[model samples]
Target: MNRLRAVVTEIEGEQNLHIITFDCAGSSLKMMGLDLPKGLHLNSHVILGIKPSHVAIAKHLSGELSYSNQLQATIASIENGKLLSNILLHVKESDVQSFITLSSSKRMNLQVGEQVTLLIKASELFVLEVLDA
Candidate 1:
């Protein structure tokens, strides 16, 4: 099962970019102005609990093939050149009918309401900083 989890409470956003606020229920992730990836609709995402082993992959968006743990979350929002995603998210407070984005590809093996467990690492979670090119 996957480990990333999120519930969107308010998707104050538009196509390709938006502010997605969620609750992890495991920790306090209150870092403001998070940088998410692009191509994210409003509801297309997977909250992930990154493990220490996957920390490098999560931060770099690259994973090893042996683990077969290819988790890629939709860009909740982007700043500078970095991408961001919310885990254990909340998106119920605001009434919306946004289209959900399936996984990055057809082979993601994910379904709506499907339970997943993320291999979380303490180092994976951190405050984002925009890198100027």
Candidate 2:
């Protein structure tokens, strides 16, 4: 799992379900679920969690996307395996890791220091741990 420290910006909804928005690496991100931990409030610091497989990569991307979280990142390192490739990206203040297919890696021609976009759906992201202000 990949973890990022984020600060809660807004929270809305009922007791059972809530739509929570947060700031992660200067980008707005949201999470919607009933299983969110307790004691979260505005400006609360939280750890955002997502799996590497859930992350998608785009090269030279343009136009709007359905994904709620889109972050601009630079390739830091890449390890191509037999069937999969592990990609390390440097975001504003965090290192985001992604697991993609080797074929896709080759097709995109991703290299170290290359600029790429990281796309992640809101539903795929969750709050791992909540901290006090």
lDDT by residue for model 1 (15-127), tens: 54444544444332221223453433344333433333232122233345333222333323212212221223112221111122223212343333333333223324332
Candidate 2 lDDT over 1-133, as tens digits, reads 8999999998888978888899987789888888557778889999989899999999999998888889999999999999999999999999999999999999999999999999988888898888783
**After superposition, candidate 2 runs with Cα above 4 Å error:** none
Point out where model 1 deviates above 4 Å. 26-46, 49-133
**Highest TM-score: which candidate?**
2
Cα deviation of 86, candidate 2, in Å: 0.0
Cα-based RMSD of the predictions, in order? 16.2, 1.5
**lDDT of each model, Cα atoms only?**
0.31, 0.91
Q: Candidate 1 vs. truth: CA RMSD?
A: 16.2
